[model samples]
Target: MKISILCVGRIKEKYWNDAIDEYSKRLSRYCKLEICQVADEKTPDKAPEALENQIKAKEGARLMAKMDPAALKVALAIDGKKLDSPGLAAGIEKAGLSGISHIQFIIGGSLGLSEEVLRASDKRLSFSDMTFPHQMMRVILLEQIYRAYKITSGEPYHK
Candidate 1:
């Protein structure tokens, strides 16, 4: 199955990019993994909350267009259900067996995902309740993907 991670904003730091690359390479043995980026919304200081919401909605629209409509979408949010490595592995295995040809993981910007994007998702996932920057979250998501692959393969990485 193809696994895609759709996120707002780009990874500008070298360290963050390297970390994401490492786990991405490891995940290739299990499935195709792709990271698709959407432009982060521009906001001026002292902007109104409504403007932030509008930006999020626009970014969500761009992200949704990049995915296959038939693919299972998982939105990563603070309120989403948290899953450990093994649990995530089980979920991924089930998704593959359940006939989902592709799975897309959506990550929003600092303001978070729009309601429309969340509504479009098949599942909601939370890595943690604590908020993380979008760039750092990229590494975390990639590592989890690799860990899930390892668990499914009955490999030592999980230990």
Candidate 2:
């Protein structure tokens, strides 16, 4: 299985990159773990909140285009469905059994993902209802993905 993490914005913090890289390496044993970074949209200094989302939407489209059409898309958003470790493991197992060749996890910019991307996704998952910075979210997502793989493979990483 190929697990691709598509995210908006670069990991500017060294710590964030280091943490995500650690999990990415761990996940590679179970499947291909790839991280795709897209340019973050610039927040207009004078735009209203509604207009801000439009900027994010434009960038979201670019990110969506980079994803493989055959892959199972999972967009990360605050309003998305929340799942625990076990639930995530179950979803991965089902995907694997279903012969999903790839799984693309989309992470939007500061304003969140556009409706089009959300509609294109097979699943929408939220780490929490509380908002997180996009950079931090990358590391968190990577860790959870590694843990999920460990859980499925009977590996000791999860414990």
lDDT of 2 by residue, 1-159 (tens): 988989888878889888987888778788988888888877877889789878878887888789798999999988889999878988988998999989999999888898889888989999997999988888888888888888888877635
Looking at model 2, report the run of 10 residues with the lowest lDDT sum: 150-159
Q: Judged by lDDT against the true structure, how good is candidate 2?
A: 0.87
- Residue 18's lDDT within candidate 2 is 85
On the 0 to 100 scale, the lDDT of residue 76 in model 1 is 95
The sequence of per-residue lDDT tens digits that candidate 1 reaches over residues 68-95 is 7899999999999999889999999999
Over 4 Å off in model 1, which ranges?
Answer: none
Clashing pairs in model 1? none
* Model 2 CA deviation exceeding 4 Å by range: 157-159
Question: How many Å off is the CA of 53 in candidate 1?
Answer: 0.6
Clashes of each: 0, 0
Q: Positional deviation of 14 in candidate 2, in angstroms?
A: 0.6
